[model samples]
Target: MSAGRDDDAQGAGAPGDAARPKVSSVLFLCGMNAIRSPIAEALARSLLPPTVYIASAGVRHGERDPFVDAVLEERGLSLGEREPQRYEDLEDGFFDLIVTMAPEAHHAALDATGTASVQVEFWPMPDPSVVTGSRDQILDAYRDLLGRIEQRIRQRFEA
Candidate 1:
């Protein structure tokens, strides 16, 4: 599914509409920190205001993907030697919003934030690693993922 407004009772306008709660902090969650979530975190940092706190984590940690670095570098962004981290590894448990990029992360976020005020959004994205082809083809998949995430972040965060 494409990234859009949270499927909540609140009416949709844009991702940053006044109808939504004020977001001071956001957490991007995925199955592994190696790819989607990290890409999101980097994009958000670049797109959102400096005052907005942004971080990313996974249901479980996985090895850092070099393709992620390549794509981010193409955009002049970087994760700065950051390592993959699990959801449980987050230093601050609370966030105004939690955006999940995978089904497992979405479920994990929902279970972890039961009854809490946090708004969790599921943005279904394909796993680029599953794409088997030439090196260029693999990079293209990563680039596609990067583009989607970047578009979503702009729509959701930019006023």
Candidate 2:
């Protein structure tokens, strides 16, 4: 565990622990996953219990967005081989909390994790694609979006 925070594997402690359920696995979702979802997953790993496995996927299985890689690089993290997967392709009964960063993702994650009784939270965040500029300029948007995702995860998951 890092000095400032506890990893999710040993998270601060889930609420209602008299008979607290197992540490919830987390699935971060987005439209294409080349961005928001992956960032959220990384941030979750840093803040939540280490045992809380995290995964991410997209609604449409679009091409891997370069911006997602760039954004994570700011924190010295890389999305190297983490290819994006369409929601329809995910295996069954895997995660406990499905976090949707895009509107479409909420429906998908719900349908995917809903049957498993997992919790779902929707976070309406901006798309780095909307950011128009040079390569460097666009990457800056990724950085900003990454910061937002990181901040939100910290607020909601950290104790």
Clashing pairs in 2: 7-48, 7-49, 8-48, 8-49, 8-50, 9-49, 9-50, 9-51
- Runs of candidate 2 with Cα error greater than 4 angstroms are 1-22, 113-116
- Checking candidate 1 for backbone clashes, the offending pairs are none
lDDT of 1 at 17: 67
Residues 86-142, model 2: lDDT tens digits: 767878546666677887887666555534555566777799888887999998888
Whole-model Cα lDDT per candidate?
A: 0.85, 0.70
Candidate 1 lDDT: 0.85
Error of 1 at 26 (Å): 0.5
Q: How does candidate 1 fare on TM-score?
A: 0.90
- The model with the greatest TM-score is 1
